[model samples]
Target chain A: MMRLDNTEIRIGFFGALAVAALATLPLFSQGYYLSLGVNLMLYAALCTAWSLFSGPTHYISLATAAFFGLGTYTVGLWVDHVSFPLLVLGGGLVAAGLAALVGLATLRLSGVYFVIFTLGLAELVRQIVSWTQTKVSTRMGLYVFTDFTEVHIYWMLLALTVAVFVTGWLIGRSRLGFAMKIIGNDETVARHVGIDTARAKILLFMISGAFIGIAGAISAPRYAYIEPPSAFNPMISFLVVIMALLGGTKRLWGPLVGVIPFTILFDQVSAQFPNHTPIVMGLAFLAIVYLLPDGVTGRLEQLRARMKRPREKLGEEVRA
Target chain B: MQIIVTGILLGGTYALIALGLTLQYGVARIMNLANGETFVAACFIAFWLFTAMQINPLVGLVIIAPAAFAINWAIYSVLLKPLVDRAKNRGMLEVDSILATFGLLFLLQGLMLLAFGGSYFSYTFLAERFMILGNPFGLNRVVAFVAAVVIAVALYWFLYRTRHGTAVRAVAVDPNSAKLVAIDVAKTAAFAFALGGALTACGGALLSTFYTFNASMGVVFTMKALIIVIMGGVGDVRGAVLAALILGITETAVASLIDPGLTIAATYALFIIVLLFRPQGMFGRQTT
Candidate 1:
């Protein structure tokens, strides 16, 4: 299992601080900027869920959106009819249930097959939601209230993001993380060493689904609407995955590194060329992959490692 | 029946699309979740060139195939190659591939949306339909079908007959041994990526004629290709065509017989069924 160290502590502390800063930005910034911050935080929380299983366990499952979509619909249905906290809980529960079902069918497959299965899952949920939305009348559809300030929801979601981060950080340094790292490293060797690869993956998979589900639940009411495009998109899952990579999957804040800049760039780009955003961002991602192979946070570690190298070598010489 | 003929013809295009993916996975042992972007990107490219240059759509294949190859090559360099290089250290092949390609997928779709609006648009090309054996079928459909078979057979021959193809096979089997045998792994990988790109474009060309596709076609094509590669078993081009035929036939048959809504569900159900029963795939060899 992988173990967290001082890096995790530093990353977590800073991650929380970033969230705290985002929560207060609304006071100083306009609605659009404040809304962007909220969007970033929401994505951060969702990305955290993605980093949990995909980051540590090293599996490719696109079902993150499926869980997210379910969570959205769950809260969308509940926000008006039920209390806020319970609505959030209901979305999370629905997401978790769906995750469990998906994991049962998916964990048996490995490699690209797992990825394809998850991708299909997202499309399936999206189509279902699209069909459902079509049947309902305008006022009676699944969308929740369209007019609500996301100010309070921002902090709440921030807190949830923190909680989820801590959960993953704690688990990242625990026996389970090590077991997963081992399984991810080599299932054959780990199974030979008596690690229950299937059980560990299933548990991690469900837990991962739960976190994304909870994020979706919170986001649905905050966003004031829920539908297939917003909820079950493959791109949504892709963002979370990329965010996890940018933050350095092994470290705690990979998703944060991925989320913050990506959102800023997206917002700024959409604002600007709005026309060529796809080609520009597509090229940007290409640039990121080609140049910054380690991602943003990963690059941070590289610089740190380089700075530490000469100092350690001098220390060794002095000792000699 | 029109459905049977259409499905089989469409299957040819599907096979071509799956060809690149199968080669990438089988030879490089890299799981590319975003490979379908090549197909959709080509669709947009064809649409743009056709509108911009007024080039004949079939003649436009010359432009789309190589361009797709280049874009896919860049994708390999930008997204997949780095992750592939790090597979040894991260021991996170599956996760890394997912995240990296997930990034690629987003960037591709985002760019597509940004460059081209989300509205569905198609190019109208007139290809007179001739009765095929006294049956009604469009000339374009026949061209697409013929292209699919030729491309599939050509790829099969490339793999079995050509030196580079042999190298690709060698890389797929064992990178270390292939290196020991003097195969340039990087070159072979680049070749595989380019080949995959070209094949996907062929499918995209066919697809552009049949349906109007925007940026969103990538994931859909990726999913359908997934079913093909899985059922076909990853390494062999022949297997891919076989799998595409089965899927194309099965899907069209089901849609013809039942509801179209069942297409995705039935396909996914088949994936689970195959996965539960044969994890190595129908024709894939068991290695790890």
Candidate 2:
């Protein structure tokens, strides 16, 4: 029931326009560019989805790999029986369900405890999946053979990215968003003010989980062969967190700014200095934490405010 | 009986690993994700010394531990001090330290990878069997266990009996009050971090005696140490030892009783259960 600000409408219009432009990318470009576009959109969706919960709440969930892996394995295990679109939906729902369960158990735990639990969740799921595979079948990995080409995957990821952006925008303006803002500021105060902190957190977490799960499902075919280790890699969670933090999670579109550059950089690092990728990634993480703790957008915002202060002071003096 | 004996032996080393983390986290107040890297680095150093110069790991520790102490102290002062100064509160400090140390983790791991290559390295030092209570154990394991216990006892005595150690514990309990009381909170934290790193590296040297290790194995050890720290209650010296033993026994029991693959999963389940029932830790006082 909130009125739309002019800036909000303008931002939305430009966002839609950008998505339209991105959708035509695959039509013009083929091999490397197309693959890179897909990778960009994949992380864009993930970082945005991660920020949806962690940005506001400051919970820092490392469970993206868990949900993403479930979504991946959902497609890997059931592509033979189910349609692709249905599998994607199933993936989101399954991940959301897991998020709800985890949120109920862990939303109360704060600080490092929550962070480690989420990290362990991925390893736990990976272990269970690996063990089950050995027991159920001699095959170590599932093949995700789909007719979908790179172009198809790119456009699908684009759609998912747009969907996540729209969802984030909507949630940002809702009552739930207001509650989350309050909760983020101080959970005890929010509870004192009669806000149901647990419910709000779980709800937002579920939404974030669903989007991430869909992103994973959409990206599964890119691998062709899916295994527990790669699907549930802890590195994915770390990358998403670093990317989102780098861009600054203050705005809905902030993660995209980080996602674009980092994806390209990662691609180059993997290709050229493949052996030193970890070193490069580690350095980047340190630089981000030390130099730009508030992220790129955040630092920019600070600079802007500083720039505007002198002008405002001058105007005040003239008026006096 | 055999399983229990093996678990106890394993748990001794685990206690040392967890103790170092407790010092770093509980006293220094930095959740050092890179703590295990120190351990791994020591292992590699031990391996190199043994293979190249024919030096015993015990002899190697004399050099490596002090080096680790100096390096970690520099790391704290150069990298983490700014973070500590800038943070407005405990939560902010925790977040900054986690991210920063996470970066350090990969940095150290990658350096180790570049230097050591992606190969498992273990040297045959005291690979012979020794009998205890009708159960067979690796002589290396027994030696490592003995070393771990001696180190833990010494650490305990220092914390309880020494003045500087008391200041470190005071800082762990309440930095603000310790500062009010004219204690150098920052200095104590830095010293504790360095000492913790040294101890962790010492544990790694011990582990290198019996356990095969590689560059990437640091995260697993870090995770295990973290679980133990949380289970025993953060900052509680006695609790961490008990928790490490419990974790060691549980993991050993799971591996022997069920599938070995499920050991990590079982560890996760136990951790989640502990987090649910006792978020403050079994031994920690409830704080709000």
Please name the candidate that would achieve the greatest TM-score relative to the true structure. Answer: 2
Model 2 misses residue B121 by how many Å? 0.3
Model 2 chain A worst lDDT window (10 residues) = A108-117
Docking quality (DockQ) of candidate 2: 0.80
lDDT of 2 by residue, B1-288 (tens): 887878888889888878889999999899998988999999989999899999988888798889999999999999999999999888899999998998999999999999988999888999998999877889999988998898899999999999988998999989989999889999999999999999999999999999889998898889889999999999888998988888888889999998888878878877888888887787877786
* Model 1 ranges with Cα > 4 A deviation: A1-34, A78-82, A132-140, A146-148, A169-175, A184-186, A280-284, B30-34, B41-119, B126-135, B161-167, B179-186, B253-263, B285-288
DockQ scores of the candidates: 0.41, 0.80
Total backbone collisions for each predicted model: 11, 0
Q: Taking the tens digit of each residue's C-alpha lDDT, what string does model 1 give over B195-263? A: 787888878877777677887668778888878888777777777887787788778887778667667
Please write out the lDDT profile of model 2 over residues A208-303, one tens digit for every residue. 999999988988998899999999998899899989999999888888778889989988998998889889879888988889988999999999
RMSD of 2: 1.4
Candidate 1 RMSD to the correct structure: 4.3
